[model samples]
Target: MKFTVAICTYNGQDRIPEVLDGLQQQTNPEGIEWEVVVVDNNSSDRTAEVVSQYSKNWRGDSQLRYVFEATQGAGYARQRAIQEAKSDLIGFLDDDNLPKENWLVEAYRFGQEHPQAGVYGGIIHPKLDVPLPPYFNKIKSLLAINNPGSQPFRYQRNDKPRKVPAGAGCVVRQQAWKERVPKQLQLQGRDEKNKKTLLIGNEETEAFFYIQNSDWEIWHNPAMEIWHHLPSKRLEKEYLLKLSRGFGLANHKLRMVRLYPWQRPLMILLTPLYLLSDGYKLASYYLRYRHEFDSDLTKACELQARIGRFMSPFVRA
Candidate 1:
């Protein structure tokens, strides 16, 4: 097969239909074989039943398959998708992500052209239900929405701080993933089922780090695009702060994953320096926005992320 679209979702019974409908509208390339697989990540809701209903009358050229992943994390669900996929190239979409008509063709074409790219992602535009805050753009990336530019580019690891594609609207080569990524990642991603679970993330970045360590390149493909639906709940101050903190908490682990064994000791020693830097940023941000801090959700979220980063070392994975 040419491509497999893997939708990983948990408790997404209400959200999966829109994504499926978007996929059904894809402008497929002639003779290009592709299929869609919905991996249910241990949902307590009727996610399976919803997919099952679709499978009954699925009229698309591609087959719609359902797989259950008992594991609770996004990483595990994606890993399961890779194992079950018949295609060498896999495009991932969260249940809330809706692709444009040309998204699949663009994603497949990019992979064909760039054989060296182990993993790549495209522009994610937010489809917010509520009015965006004035400063929402400041922390919008925390919501997994990004647009590097109109041009496609390779992400160089040598850049001061490394950057990798978010799992949403991302495509990965099966070979690279099977060879480089470990079955179990240090960060297992968020468990929506567990209310008290730490909002730890970076599972996708961790896998990308392994793939990047090899000869494969990571890229940003602007041609491929998707709309990430953001409900009002996600815009709430509490949710955004938690999301930021989760990303921050996973920062240290990702740093360690990207480093060589010899480099880890030095990274550990530099923990104090990192903490001081994060502390400075936090203090400076608070000082600048103290008057509006309570009302400024974006600023408050930034502060929470900084705090998470400062405490990352002490927090066990």
Candidate 2:
């Protein structure tokens, strides 16, 4: 089956060139059909202009196209990609992600070979615009830096199913998106405004569990790798807290989604208990890092996320 490299960008004219360059560098085997589809999610900048220029310069068998998703969220852009993509497998690369040259080729090969896995993801290392902070290694996992080792395996950690695929460098089958996600699940993801200010968002994470429940297996293909750009701004204590809160909110939403309609009422009754459990976990982490400069960030983030999750029921879709 052919593969579609789907990059979601919002006001990314400045940051998208590297990602486009990475795609232009792809080494495709003859007869392998693939394409690059960039979903411009309501960009205020010249993101479309940059992509249009690159489309003319694309050299590989993969054709480049620019799609405009007027919606502001990444989830909406992703859903648009699902519709716009011509291929069965859609490999997602965030706007700032710099994929390895073989990313497209390996993704196509892996999806072609592994029919059982509906979704597959690879490693994501940090592409830092600034020097790494001394405390970075302590929270790399939270930062979305994933290695999962050089050995390829099914999506699992310590013999349990992995929670979510890496945000970027994730290759998902159109079949899975069609079967598991009938439509974009409420479009609860980051907007440019949120990223700049609140930082509260979880665009794709919640869908992982929904897809898994549909019996679509998830996998890790080590050969498919990308570098996710982490600017100095994202490395700040405040941003981490915001991201952490987003994670919590997303996790709660995932749990809420798993409930049957009949169970939601009872789940509502049990919400406090659930939040309390999360609170304890947050407290434990806080105590562990309390002396550090960013000690309270995680705890505060969890609190904010839990609050958002609890309020999710009231939010109109």
Candidate 3:
């Protein structure tokens, strides 16, 4: 089976080399084909040039190609990668993510076994560039670091939708994307030029829901591993607050079906109660973890998120 591994970047020139090197070292099964496609998300730096250098010097079994996506958001880059991909299975990796040696092979095996699966993703351990705060352990999930388990489980149709596979280090099936990620479901990720604003961005998570609704399954594979590099700036209070609000906005955007546009106003009206409930929950979390974390970062995030969710209909829809 052929595989298209996509790496989306914005001003990631220096880090792209390590990610490319990791892909180069992948140990795919003999005769199985794989390639890495680097999508430059309108980078201001030499990201394109660096990737081109690696592409020209590639000596591994996998092929390497570079695509310049003039669009400014990571969402646009991801969509372009899907369009440029030629394989039945498309694996996504961020510019700083370093995948394990057997990532491709394991993904291929899972895809072969579960033709019904829509997406597959695994652990995202932190590769910190700075010291972790005492509260870091209590709030790591906010950082997008996930480690579900060490087994593979295909999701089933349950009352509540299954948990979304984390966006990083995941492989998406072409059939699933074609069925779910059409124009109706497309959502913009971050806008690189406007660095100050935090917009909605649970794009991959929303896609999994669409695919599941289309009678497709989502799987979590523990064997597929990658490192998510986190810098000191990301751990700051201001950035964390923005991320919290972004999460709130993204959650609302991901679930609000424009097909039922009439319901948006109702949701918007009920936002206050939801935020109040969230406030109560925030208090509970603080009471539970106050000894560990001194600040009410999580509480502030929830309030901001509720505000964003209330505004999601106007902002994204």
Candidate 4:
């Protein structure tokens, strides 16, 4: 089967080298042909330079091509990838990740085994510089929260050909793309109801649901793994707060599909406790590492708390 690996990049020159090297190391399949197509989202950095170097120097049958997406967001880049892809089976790897040597081979194998499966996703593990704190670890295990200590993960489906949706290190079957992603994703945004805005974090998740609801399966194989590098600049408390606020925005947008109203009350009751507990733990780390706390961190926390309140009302709809 022929496959095209679609990569969406923005100012990702520093990280592209590792991703390129990892693809080069793939044990080439005999009859299977694969190539990497990078969609550059108006990068002002040396991304084009790095990709050009790889095209010239890399010794592989897999072709490399770069397309410019003048649009600003990731959704725009990904949309272009769908249109530009050469094969029906598409592999997606972020610029900041290194897929396992067998990533493509395994994905293709799974596709062959399950002809009806449209979306195939794999495991994403954080490449952390240091171990997480004890308290943070405990809270993570207890609360089932996902963040620095844990990478986003979906369980293998209970039913065969299940709906597993996560974008980080995954493959998309062409039929699945035509049926689910492009149309709804264009309208959905982060919320299921707000079909006007571009979908953010939950694009992949919603696609999985659509696939399963339409009678196709989603698969998650643990063996298909990718090492996701955490941005060094994002290792601070301020950064986590920013990340949390961004997550809150996505969550608030998603809450608009609420079937019940008590969701807001639940958030109101729970937000303070979560903030105090997680906040104190984060503060301890900030004090120890940066030796100073700033207003951005405070603002991020406030945004998250307020977002929770804002989301509560939507739950009733």
Candidate 5:
């Protein structure tokens, strides 16, 4: 079976090389027909030039190709990648994500073994450039650093506080995505041009919701793994708070996607109940940790997220 590795980037000229290097060092991909496609999402930097230069001297068995996507948004870029891909199985990697040497083989093997799986993701360990902040574990998920133990398991579809795989280092069945996901998603991820205004996320989760609603299942494969490089800026309180709020804002839309059209009104009516619970938690958290709130980035992020969720019903889809 053929496979495609798609790296979606925006102004990631400096970070894309290391990811390419990781792909180049794959251990055992002899029989597998795989190629790497870099989708440049309206980058203002020298990303195109760097990928072109690398493609000229790429030594891996897989051919390196670059595709430019004029429309800005992670969702758009990924959609373009799916269309341009030559293989039915596509693995997505962010420009900053570095995979292990056996990532390609393992990811492909898992997909081959499980035809029922529409989407699957593996462990993501953080490669931090800065020191860990107080209560880092509480907000580490915002950075897409996930390690859900060593065993592989299918994600429960009916679980509250739903668990979905992060876009980073995740593999998808092209047929599943094409059949279920819409051409234009409500949550389009962060747009570079409107960086200050747009913070809404969960474009991938929205897609997963549609896929899981069908006969497909989502799984977590322990054998495949990647390291997400986190710079100091991502660890800053401001960025973390913004990320938390973005995720919270997307929660309602995701909830609506999972429910039937008839159940949406009930979900909307239940929004106040969710807000009340979140409000109590936020207030209690502030009261208990008033003194440490300033320094405790995790608590601050949680409060911001709660506030975002409270305002989610009003936010336009």
Candidate 6:
């Protein structure tokens, strides 16, 4: 069966080259036709220029194509790619990630081996120049490690047949996703006001949830890998704060999605407590790690509270 690699990018000029290069190097099966489709999510940078350059020069057997969507969201780009995919199997990779040469090969192999599964995900690693702190590394040990260009992970035990992840490195059947995900939920992407902000989080998680409920098996292959680049900006405290707030907002949205309508009322009561405790732990971590003092602690704490307030009324409304 033919497979199409769908990539979504937003202002990804500097990173797209390596990803394209990695794709060009991939070795596919003799009869399997593969192609790459890049959906540009309204990039203001030289992203289009870079991809255009690569498309012109790529020598791979798989075709390369670039499409532009002015809607300004990753979800929007992803949805467009899904619609345009020419293959029955669709693989997703971020512009910032460098996937392995045999990534799609392994994905197809697993799909053939277990025709029951609709979704499959591989490993991901952070391409960091500096070593993470001991505490962070310890936590990461339990999770996937990010190294530049190479990430290794052991396959999750297949004992429990549960919902699997479609985030990062994943290949999914087009027919399965179209049947399981609502058009409304697939509209994930960047916020219109601030292009840098993601409109949703846990989008893949939500999709996997639906797939699981549909009685589709989600598979995990630890052998396949992708190296995710981490810029210095992502390492800063402010960005981490933004990430936390976004995560909190996503949690709020999941509740609104009626995933747990019965538990929504409980969240309303627990939100304030949870935000306060989270703020305290983050504040302590900041005070210990960051030597310079800043009163942004107050602002950060207030932001978390504001998110809770915003979510509370939205659920009711």
Best by TM-score: 1
TM-score of each: 0.94, 0.87, 0.86, 0.70, 0.94, 0.75
**Tens-digit per-residue lDDT, 110-187, candidate 2:** 987998788888989988888888767756766778888798887642244346667688998888878877475853
For residues 1-317, what per-residue lDDT tens digits would candidate 6 score against the true structure?
Answer: 28889998878888888899898888866557888899888778998888888878886577888999888666677778888899878889888778888887887677777666778787777776566643344333212343322342322323353334546778878888898877666326345337444234356666666665565677667767888776666555565455545544555554444344465678768667766765576566556645433544434534553454344333321
Residues 1-37 of candidate 5: C-alpha lDDT, one tens digit per residue: 3899999999998999999989888886456878899
lDDT of each: 0.87, 0.75, 0.76, 0.62, 0.86, 0.66
lDDT of 4: 0.62
Q: Write the per-residue lDDT of candidate 3 for residues 1-317, one digit (tens) a residue.
A: 38889998889988888898888788866557788888988888998788778777885677888899996777778888888898989999998788889888888888888888889888889999887777676567777789988888876545364477778999999878987776544467677666834554577767776776666778888888999888898788888778777776665566553223465678777666766765676567556665653356665665566666655545643
- The predicted structure with the larger TM-score, 1 or 3, is 1
Candidate 5 regions with alpha-carbon error over 4 angstroms: 196-200, 275-277
lDDT of 1 by residue, 1-317 (tens): 89999999999999999999998888876657899999999999999999999888885678899999997787788889999999999999999999999999999999999999999999999998888878778888888989998999999877777889888999999999999998888888887777533545578989999888878999999999999999988877788888888877887788888886678889868888988888898788778888876887777787788778877777775
Model 2 residue runs over 4 Å out of place are: 156-162, 194-201, 258-266, 280-317
Per-residue lDDT value at 124 in model 3: 89
lDDT of 1 at 148: 90
Please say which candidate is ahead in lDDT: 3 or 5: 5
Considering summed lDDT, which 10 consecutive residues are worst modelled in model 4?
138-147
Q: Is candidate 2 or candidate 4 better by lDDT?
A: 2
Ranking by lDDT: 1, 5, 3, 2, 6, 4
Off by over 4 Å in 3: 156-162, 184-186, 257-294
In model 3, residue pairs whose N, Cα or C atoms come closer than 3 Å (at least 3 residues apart or on different chains), thus clashing, are none
Question: Distance from true position, residue 173, model 6, in Å?
Answer: 1.1
